[model samples]
Target: MSIVVNLQSKAKPETTTKLISFIEEKLPAVRGFSGCMQVSICLNRDSGDLLFYEKWSSKEAHEKYLLNIQNNGVMAQLMSYLSDPPTVNYYESLDI
Candidate 1:
């Protein structure tokens, strides 16, 4: 099953643009990884929220990426823009 990691960021409005740009720049490196399926960034029209969708070939692939991120302290750098811990949801593709 494909693993989908949905991240919702509660960053302030003024910082949203730079926050998105930061992630966009970093995403290319992640998308180049072996198991990455797809990556998308979206803004919620209603709430002005930011969302990051990451699809991976398998749970192990995602887990490995997470582990590497922690070990390298890459995840720590993301803390500056967060209003709270990012809300992460794991899901399986039911149709696509």
Candidate 2:
């Protein structure tokens, strides 16, 4: 089944702009990644928290993408922008 993933991160206030710019530059890669169906991001200005919503073909697909980025240093770069480690959760759509 396809899965939806949510990643929440609190950006360092001073690095928020850099974080946004980084994502803007990298988003095309993310959107084009295998199994990725859609991606959306929202920010809570008050808390400096970013919410990333994504849809993927499967949980394994998402995990695979994570591994790819981890090896290529994208994960490390992302961590540098955050005040706290990001939290991720996944869910499957419910049939109506």
Candidate 3:
């Protein structure tokens, strides 16, 4: 089964609009990345909470993707719109 990755961050209020535009522009490359099944962004308007919902072929694939972004400065660019460092959690489906 694919792994689900949830990445959450609080956007700086002033930059929230720009952040959404940035994510929209960047989503295509992410979706085309190897092992990425799907990815989407969700935002809470009132609280400025941003969520990155992703599915990948496996944990290793997602890790590889992270390393790619980190080394390429994409991660740094993305972080600049946020109020603080983001939190990430990976999930596996239950047999039920």
RMSD, each candidate, Å?
A: 2.2, 0.7, 1.1
lDDT of 1 at 54: 92
Off by over 4 Å in 2: none
Looking at model 1, the pairs that clash are: none
Could you estimate the TM-score for every candidate?
A: 0.81, 0.97, 0.94
Candidate 3 lDDT, tens digit per residue, 40-86?
A: 88999899998999999999999999999999998999999999799
Q: Write the per-residue lDDT of candidate 1 for residues 15-46, one digit (tens) a residue.
A: 66777787877888789877999988887645
lDDT of 2 at 90: 97
Segments in model 3 whose C-alpha atoms lie over 4 Å from true places: none
Report the C-alpha lDDT of model 2 over 1-96, residue by residue, as the tens digit: 788999998999998889999999999999999999999999887899899999999999999999999999999999999999999999996666
Model 2: colliding residue pairs: none
Per-residue lDDT, model 3, residue 88, is 91
Please give the RMSD of candidate 3 to the true structure.
Answer: 1.1
Top candidate, metric TM-score: 2
Worst 10 residues of 3 by lDDT: 87-96
* Per-residue lDDT of 13 in model 2: 92
* Candidate 2 global TM-score: 0.97
